[model samples]
Target: MAILDIFVNFIQVSMPRSNVIILTDPASQFSMEKSSTTVLPIQGDYSRGNLMLQRIMSYITFLEQRLKEHPERLKCINHYIFTDSDIALVGNLGQIFEKYHDFHLALTFRNNKDQPLNSGFIAVRGTSDGILRAKAFLQEVLEVYSTKYMKASRMLGDQLALAWVVKSHLTFATKKFSRPEAFSGDINGKLVLFLPCLIYNWTPPEGAGQFHGMPLDVQVVHFKGSRKRLMLESWNLFNSTSNLSDMLCLILGSGRTKYDF
Candidate 1:
């Protein structure tokens, strides 16, 4: 099997029992039988911008409708949103959620960009207030997507929408936990917390040879931009040798010997 195939298999085998939902094209070959995981197949010829916008809209809409149909099911559950391409390298996500129990939404910053937040990976609490804020956030994004003025700007779709929300509504606050910075604000008289980027959604620097080490507590590694290949190669090497240091060396393209381990 190919290296990426091996990496994908490892992720499937090791994924936690949390509610993992994936949004992808219907024809994708990725499959999982976990009872806690749900794969929502998307069908459309949308542009990259439109596809992300629709994915967020669809997921929020599904959550809203499900809660409406069964209010009791909303008890004691948290909703996590991730793009299909993201990977969980290490850490139990349930623990991460527990650590940030007070936060309503958790998101990370984009690497090598001026954008303060990335919509690819997010965590949302299950409270009624959290759900309402998420719905409002999605609605604001939809409006931006629908408008020609904002859509014509450099950032479109989810990123632009999230940027707008952070600028206008979300307020930054310092938390005493591992990730000190968080965004907190009120929505319709309810307090909502948006956790810092380093807590949940961490991305490696962009570029082939730029290999600054990841934070020790990064829960999710978003292989955004052109670094997917590097991440796959590192994963393949790590699986074979089980040496994280070597994997880091390979990912960074440092002069360290790949066979040293």
Candidate 2:
């Protein structure tokens, strides 16, 4: 349960508060530990076009507040991991944490040649030298890309801001720094090495139901989009496959998923 922060969008959805379904159900098993699991109820003014921008701003604000509350924990860890609620713990997470100890940033996947940047999952060591470099890069993004500062700058999005910053400033000293098993091949060009993901990816030439009766080879199947149905679908597929445990543990720790509250 070595975690830094928790952010959820449950509070903002327009539904009955009492009946509101949350993604928290999946993580009920891991909540009892002494991890710093802070659940963030969603903010009211966040809109789709600027949701990412607002979240980043909120993250910075929350980090500052936490520092004010617990000044001693500032240097305890380098960076914090921001995980999407839909993500699951398929195996032990120690391997990913180890990289955070060694590098300034980490993610389960790498950038492709054309779009060599995937910001879905990131580990940011706040104390590392990379932070200084990223500061300048982030500043450029704030000044140029953010609608708050620059109006005419139409870019792919804010995630790219982080991706371009990291890809430009950070250096991988070893092969182990990257998550080699996260993704196998090109989105539509190469054959994925492990389980063929129908959830996280929707690249063409192969899609959901692409391999109707074929066995899956991936370790963890990340349901990056359309989460609720994706998880159910993955679970159905997982139950049918006997060789999934070994593959899943590569990403999520072998322990069961848990929740705090």
Candidate 3:
């Protein structure tokens, strides 16, 4: 429930108007009376194989239901930030939309040569045009997956397919050369802004030489593996102090002492 804590105490505390919509499975769903949160459980006992595809389908289903139930409410929202639960919010997200308002969608990309574009954190505009672009993009990814995606494992069929789509379709004009930089591209004519993974969907390895405990510039931190413990550590120490720099002691005490950055 770290996300719930981060939302209620931190995120909602600042942006009280924002709503948290969680699409989870029935077994893991939390039944709570959160005024600004809506938890909708997907109807299925989906196997571990290809859960990402199921989630994309579930998202489409949820949007269709919302369109039928509250079309007016949908019109009021200008954008939506799609991210995984494992990530923690430490920095201001308002800067992304404010700065990259021209693009219809924004996606984070890893620095790796294989599967560079990570789909964990996506910022999509909620306008009609943006919605159409998102729909088209997902449809294209699904199409590509059906025809070309050879999964390394059953899970994350969507991510791998997404990588193919980005490489083949989301082409930029000039070469991008920088870390933590934001650049724009087009996917079948739909504009998509690519933000560096170091700043957006960052993993522990990204901050190997730097201070990793919620840096002032990072907006989200994606704990991909055992690094998830860092989230727990941060939450445990969350109420103790207001200064984020103090988190270094916990990191150092945990047997990691390379703090040259």
Candidate 4:
């Protein structure tokens, strides 16, 4: 099976039973409207391959309407939004949410300094304040890009806009956002929480196992680059054996799953 097929199956099977919504393009072949899982339709102009920004905006708009309609059911609940490319390695989502429950918004960091925040995986509490802030952030990003000063690039898309929003609103001076337990200090008005990249959004170089060593605590593996074949090979190798050592050996021995970035 294709890597994307595997990814979809993983999401469909392992998704938490909470109110989970999968946002997809209107033209997509996959659509599920059921009790636990709801596949919402989103339409956007494909400009320079930056349709992700439009899809994200559509999701936020949908959430805003839902919040207006069902205010009581969404109270204090956690809403996790992930891209289609992200794969779930661990199944205990409640534990992860409990670990970062103090913050209104939780985002994973990209592997490098160039793209510090990866909007691919975002978790937001269902509180009124949390939803409001998240909606404001997304709206402001779109507004900024629409203005004359900022020109949106196809290479980065929503990632650049998100970074600008966080930097403009939040303060990262103290170690509060970086360390989970150090959140006792006053945030000085910042509502965003930065999760450890290794645990939440393990990427190529570190997650490939042979390169930087895959830590035992990796919860999600994000395949950001364009190489789908290698990602599938890696996923298959990781799931082929029960022993971690054997898995690593099988992955390293094949030499076909080497990640480029």
Candidate 5:
């Protein structure tokens, strides 16, 4: 869980203006009181490829219900995001939202054709239509999973399902990912934007070294697969912590759990 400490450090330093919501199962090992972010207990199996869809649907539903209950809250927020815990924010996320203010749903893409998109990082504008479009698009992904990917969706996790929807429904205006511009598109009638993984969802390269690090411009580092240790490594490389024990105090808030994943 030291990685979580590092995660919190990054947020507190780089994106202090942002809020984090951590959805966990009953068996999670994170301590809510020790954590600086909101730790929400969710009812579901935390395994991949389950009917819970890795709680993607649950998060979206939670936001939907919250806004329905407090309609005015929507006008006050600028952007809302959903991301996996295995990530570290390194750049100012607000800058991206400020520049691409028109997008309803923003997703990140990888180089692989088989798995072109990674669903770990998702950004939704806070505008009424933006939220509505995100809900509509994500809900449609559920339908697409059942109708298109079927068993494969469960086996490969939600990324496959999400990619299926993007390919089958959206029409892209630009395809280049290294142009410093978004791969803007339209899904049905809603606006969608695709950001390169190198910029927003960076993962380790095949032959990356122990000291490997991302480019200075990368907004986030997604510690996908078994690279969670790299998060702590990178954090230490960038920031000097004199008292490791004291710094670990600013962790995910109050309760204990059975497992870390």
Candidate 6:
């Protein structure tokens, strides 16, 4: 069994639950969701807009609780996959796992000046020591992210902390999957590739592009804003291929198995 987790902050006006559902629906094949699947809504003193680092830290804290509560779930799972709510799945991720059995951990490297790797898509699977290292890194992040007074700090929060810690602990088998040319699926038959276009189509500052012409192909459109508008738009234009309807229905409809905190 493999476990996958996604963190969605309730505070972000962009990429609301509706948008996230639309992005994920097409990728979902299992009639039954994973045993430990969950979305944690975190409410803290985080500011709006440039609070991504803070949100990530908060989500890390949330994961601490999830791990504590569901240790059994982790034991059954061979690999743990994490993707941002905004990212959509297009290709066969499960197939990638089958192809890349040797890789215990994987991530997409971001193109920062330091060329820091992106934490948006993360996979971890290995001995208990590896898990311990991941947790220790989280702890270290908490230490550096907080002030003596508990206010958030800007010191390379989640991405940097993760890059540094994971580098120390596990071996990264692939580069960041930001573009298709950089993606080489030859890693033990497993694949970890980024896209030039949006697998998770984030709303552009300009406007939506013509989905038909885009080359690399998009798995999911990560709409940071206009979730409702997009849903309504999807409803109005229901082509057989449109995933918007499915996503909107999931969000507008409800009956999730409520877990007791």
The prediction achieving the highest lDDT against the true structure is: 5
**RMSD in angstroms, candidate 2?**
12.0
- Give the TM-score (vs. native) of candidate 2: 0.50
Cα lDDT of model 6 by residue, 1-261, tens digit? 111222222111223322221122222343324233343445554554325455555545544544665566666544444555544343444444565554434555533434255555655443343344444544554554443313323334556554444344334422443343334222222333432333323222223332223224333333333343343333334334456445434332321212121
Candidate 1 lDDT by residue in tens digits, 59-143: 6665566468556666756665544454534455656456656665555653323356667666566676667766666676667
State residue 256's C-alpha deviation in candidate 1, in Å.
10
Q: Give the whole-model CA lDDT for all candidates, comma-separated.
A: 0.56, 0.37, 0.66, 0.58, 0.68, 0.40
Runs of candidate 6 exceeding 4 Å displacement: 1-44, 49-51, 66-73, 103-105, 112-116, 126-131, 140-221, 224-261
| Candidate 3 C-alpha lDDT tens digits along 1-261 | 765555444455335667778777888857656777788787854568756766666656654554454567667765778777777666767678777778777778765655777767877778767766776676777677767763743665677777778877644422452355778878777888888877777665434464445334666667565665665676568657865555534543433433222
Q: Indicate the TM-score of model 4.
A: 0.75
lDDT for 11 (candidate 5): 77
Better of 4 and 5 by TM-score: 5
- Mark the regions of model 4 whose C-alpha exceeds 4 Å error after superposition: 12-20, 32-36, 75-78, 148-152, 171-190, 206-210, 234-261
Q: How many residue pairs clash in each candidate?
A: 0, 29, 1, 0, 13, 13
Query: Residue-wise lDDT of candidate 4 within 1-261, one digit each (tens)?
Result: 265555654454456455556666677768544456567776665454567656567757766875686666776466655554545444455565567667666677644544567767776666777677766656776765555223455556577766666655555622343443322112334366676667776554524454655556666666656445555765576556535455434433433355453
Once superposed on the true structure, which residue ranges of model 3 sit more than 4 Å away at CA?
1-10, 13-16, 27-29, 66-71, 171-179, 206-216, 248-261
The stretch of ten residues in a row with the least summed lDDT in candidate 1 is: 252-261
Q: Please identify which of the two predictions, 1 or 2, would achieve the higher TM-score against the true structure.
A: 1
lDDT of 5: 0.68
* Global Cα RMSD, each model: 5.2, 12.0, 4.2, 4.4, 7.0, 11.9
Ranking by lDDT: 5, 3, 4, 1, 6, 2
- Residue 9's lDDT within candidate 2 is 20
